[model samples]
Target: MYLKIDERIFRELFHTYYDRLYTGFYKKTGSYEQAQDLTQQTFIKFWRYRDSYNPELSVEIQLFRKGKLVFIDWLRKESKERQMIDSLQQQEKIPVEELSADLKDSLNQAIDQLSPMRKEVFNLAYIEGYSHKEIAEKLNVSVRTVETHVYKSVQQLRKILALIFIMLHL
Candidate 1:
């Protein structure tokens, strides 16, 4: 109930179970990189909640349960993103070249509001079409970090664009 996983034990467990977990995740997700990311997410969850480990329960069960959750969250995020893109497409109706200069300026302002690192990540990801792994390697940060910045930046930009659309319509 209150078992704490010390570094040595954690390392042992990680080494022993990592491949199994990775294989399981890959089987479910059918993507090597996604499986790796989900595996890392599950281990990160385990490390954060190490004190909550119930010794009576099987470690495999607990780890897989966390993996299931991580996968579910990833799915939900992906769904929301897809919906956002669809909604934006429907709302735009106007072609990019036809967008008013005012709208373009507002979009620029929204991007300008992002943190410097996030702005760079967003540009690299969406503008320059860099992959998340490429951005991570270029920035010398983890893939998760690049993913987070890009996700947050897109969400922020969407909100701003929605506001701008409303204002323009009004």
Candidate 2:
């Protein structure tokens, strides 16, 4: 018998897939909270795009594909923005570095915490002045993934440094 999925069906799907989706994303992105956010996002996308359902196909499969695509697309966007920010940071165009040695060191420390891949991406783009294409070829990943990693890394670095500043001042 074919199935008819309603709002309740979607709700149940959300609960059922939440942990699996979150775990999959967390493995790729290496953040618990980010995984949680992406899990919620996957469900959100499922709700918004529910009309695309094909009852002939498995509902679980549809949901899983959608969630994975959403996560990948998000990562791609985040990486590009990170590359841009890396360029901006390299220029020291702002007076932020002029603030204090402690602040600068804290910022450096947080950057130092990133995965080797992320650090390499940032360094090649900003410090070594490598193009995204070049970085992608060197890293054996698509340039799009490179951009996503860069964006997420920069965003994470910013948040980490901000918290460090607060803690240092306190």
Candidate 3:
């Protein structure tokens, strides 16, 4: 069977421009793997939106612009994660090493009290540094479900720790 016009154009575009786009992304990102991922995402976007392609304009220019947007989105996501970590540190002035042994035990116990799935999600997000989307993909669940698990886990930990502290004081 003959290929459709859009499919033929995409195959030609991918073969001709993939390496060039990957080089540009690598230079901007300084990570070979990330550059490859960004380049692949750009092509995926182009294929998905092939109907919107404007024949009058340069397809190469459009692909490059899409890559730029993807990079900006990645940067924004990283910034938000950094800010959250910074705020958590700011809220707790005491370093983890300085925490008393009893306090450390309390924290461990609090985490252990969580449901198996919630505990796993908490560890992935907090200890493993995985994003919500990544955790969802790894667990084969929806992003919203991952978010809910993490949110509830945090809330449960806070309450459990607070009770432990009060009981220890009394």
| Top-TM-score candidate index | 1
Off by over 4 Å in 2: 1-4, 94-170
Write one digit per residue (lDDT tens) for candidate 1, span 34-53: 88999999999998998898
| CA-lDDT, candidates in order | 0.82, 0.78, 0.81
RMSD of each: 6.5, 9.6, 10.3
Q: What TM-score does model 3 achieve against the real structure? A: 0.54
TM-score of predicted structure 2 = 0.52
- Give candidate 3's root-mean-square deviation (CA, Å): 10.3
lDDT by residue for model 3 (1-170), tens:
22233777789999999999899889987878779998999888877777776666687887778878888987897577556544553553344567789998998899999999999998887767788899999999977578768767877999999999999999
Q: For candidate 2, lDDT tens digit of each residue in 14-107?
A: 7787888989989988878778888888888878877767878888898888888888898897787766856754654334436577867786
Which candidate do you rate higher for TM-score, 1 or 3? Answer: 1
Clash statistics: count for each candidate = 0, 6, 0
lDDT of 2: 0.78
Instruction: Give the higher-TM-score candidate: 1 or 2.
Output: 1
Lowest lDDT 10-residue stretch of candidate 2: 88-97
